[model samples]
Target: MKRSELLTRIVITIFSLGVVALPLALWAQTPLIHARIAEGGGWNPDVIQAKVGEPLYLKFTSDDVMHGFAVGQMDMQPVDIEPGKVSETTLTFNKPGIYTFFCTRWCGLNHWRMRGTLEVTGSETNPPEPASPPLYVTLDLNLDAPHLAEVVPTEKASARRGAELLRQLNNLPTYQSPDYYRLRSSVQVFQDLSGSGLTDSQRWDVVAGIWQSNTTPEGFAEGKELYAQNCAACHGEFGGGDGVFADDLAAAGTASMQTMNGDMAMSMQTPANFSDPQRMLGASPALLQGKILRGGMGTGMPMWGSIFTHEQIWNLIAYMYSFQFDYPR
Candidate 1:
């Protein structure tokens, strides 16, 4: 070979080696979401947002029937795994947008229900932090959403069924208050959240916030003021259950806390005296708050939920606990 050609070939080889090494070096440093696939219908990661050009190493398996995984834009073919076998595939996404994957197998009746989404984000040196997941109050009954919701065979039916189930479970018909109505209507739809979308514990906290709320006054003085504004009207300015509204309220069944308790005593209701530490001793702050919010559903006791803020409610509860001791009579 000529001297000039030989030198040129050597340089080109060296440069090509560096180019190949560069991408692999970057891949070595890149982080991956590791997960195991089992008898589930969908991908272990149903929803994930990743940077473009990043590799997704899916350690997937299927112990039931044959399963397939495919991404349309990536020109990727479905990787199939038979029953009792492990399967894997490395997909390096080059596009910057949302991509979806689904099981192309008619494994079962819920085969269409098995799908997930992936969001390939644009190239940026420092990506912004992901937003916090919705509170349980925000979780839709439709486990598959926006994109995932489309692929379902009976989308409308699934949504309708899910909505009905939620209403029945939460006792929506008997549940009053505009707040609850709004909440019920908001969660009628569904979304898929099989991936690391939101941890179970976080979802539970959101549920807790929706179903219950409790807060204690910072200290005694604040508690006293809160009591005066909310409770004094019925319980008396001194927490003696002798305010001006007390008599009228008693006639309505709500003002008479003791009587209401007795009428519902056979049931689960336990109306305790705010001033009687013995009666109120075991009552939890949360339980007390719920009791006060709901009132007697079918009875004369109207729900006072609209009248008090969350903070005020807690403070009032604290003040009720304090009623055990007379305020200088």
Candidate 2:
């Protein structure tokens, strides 16, 4: 052959070789499709569709027990899966069709059914777009009518005061989990105040009747002492709303002095004005008792009916009535 023709022939051969290697280069550059073997015996998805020539990458996990992940009839190692653990693999599917995978290990009776399929199509490319936001909703069955009721005392006496204390606790805010966690300190304080030996019911009785009338001045003094011992931290000694726990209670959105500002409009909620003569003066003993038993609705007032005995509630009422005598504006 001529020298020029030989050179031209070599150039043509080089160009042809480049054309032949181009497809292989493109194939090596294909993106991989990654998937997981999630716990619960089921793949996160039982079916996956991929375009031919795309690389397949598999990720799997077993949240409960050990299981095997085999794809397209290919034998895989008996990977010991554990709870909260995961495994993965990569395989390229050159052909288009339905490919199935199953667990090879004896993962229990349902191991046979612990299988899934992947569909491969050549024409389509790109995954489908997500249609909507993954919105989560919950039905709160516990948030219906308040779990409290009001009761009226038949007479105006110290027991009504006891009933009011019950109302205070009953109307306590619906504590969040965090709030309850924070209450640990308050619980300790309360336990120290009433002593731990008392049952929940007894402690409530002490708190309710600690402030009421007494057959003697000494009895009344004893009641006041008890109030200081068991109730002063939250209700204040004079019931003027200053309490050791008031700030913490308010921070946790519990009712407190700051919440019971004089102007009902500035108050966190409409607080019961104990000094209001029209509201308090005309109230019959029965009405006052009822108010103590059943706290005002939608406020932090709670039902004290179950917390104090009827007699205890009456004594507390008399003590509260004494507030009128001492602090009548």
Candidate 3:
């Protein structure tokens, strides 16, 4: 090699070494976070600080059972940490905000308690505009209030059975409107169809059809997946409020309530049974949306507004109502 060429090659080698060393240096600075069952200590040093528009490196180790880590609302793959093993990942935040990091696995009954926050501060790349209020908020719904349906279908309602009736009805556009469909409960929609001369069952079928129209097969599938991953732990595979964690959740709640008041001590209420027609039929989709986004206050439900996208929330709503209406899988 020529003298000059040899010097150039040496310089290039040194530059590559620096590039590799920079990331290693950053990775070394990150402390190893530990994960364990909720009872043991869900996530140690759960709070983390990072700068916006900068890449972050993290290290994690499982002290007990297998655990997976993923940030809420992020599009990154989850990192699985085996017992006594270290898992490392990198992330970059573009905006300044608080982000949630949670365990993706069901380690135990209190698995939902495995959560942490990432506080990203620095210059905002693009300042986000305020979003409009959710429908439940604008409607001023009392989510905790008892909402019971006066009438329920004698048999399970079917969207396929009501499709033709939905198409033939006058003022159908009014009923098909998104605002109308989301704000009105199944029972309310059935009452609206009263003067149309359809039998009670058919009216409910029409309501089912109306709901089916608002969501697509793709939405339902996505919702089903999301529910399985996030909600099934608490609500159950069939929306029966009998998930593996249900009993434990009730006990945890009851324990907390006992501290609130001695005279009114009572066991915590069980998770809502979506299959209960009387309650599900009376509750509007908007109301369910509110309860989901805001969470069940003091009810052990975690707020998901920071985790799921708006479209995802709507998809969950559609999938949940499937417990009431027979929409084919």
lDDT of candidates 1 onward, in order: 0.47, 0.46, 0.88
TM-score of each: 0.28, 0.26, 0.92
- Give the per-residue lDDT of model 3 (tens digit) for 73-186: 888899998998899888999878899999999898767779899999999867798989988889999888989999999999999887778877755778887789899998
Taking all chains together, the TM-score of candidate 3 against the true structure is 0.92
Provide the lowest-lDDT 10-residue window in model 1: 147-156
Error of 2 at 146 (Å): 20
Among all candidates shown, the one with the greatest TM-score: 3
* After superposition, candidate 1 runs with Cα above 4 Å error: 1-219, 252-272, 298-301, 325-329
lDDT of 1 by residue, 251-302 (tens): 5454444666655532222223355433343343444556565555643233
Model 2: how far residue 203 lies from native, Å: 39
Between 1 and 3, whose TM-score is larger? 3
Clashes of each: 8, 33, 0
lDDT of 2 by residue, 197-292 (tens): 645544433222332222235544544653464345545666645555555445534344355553342222333444332333333334445644
lDDT of 3 at 184: 90
Evaluate residue 316 in candidate 2 and report its C-alpha lDDT on the 0 to 100 scale: 57
Candidate whose lDDT is highest: 3
Query: Which lDDT value does model 3 have at 253?
Result: 74
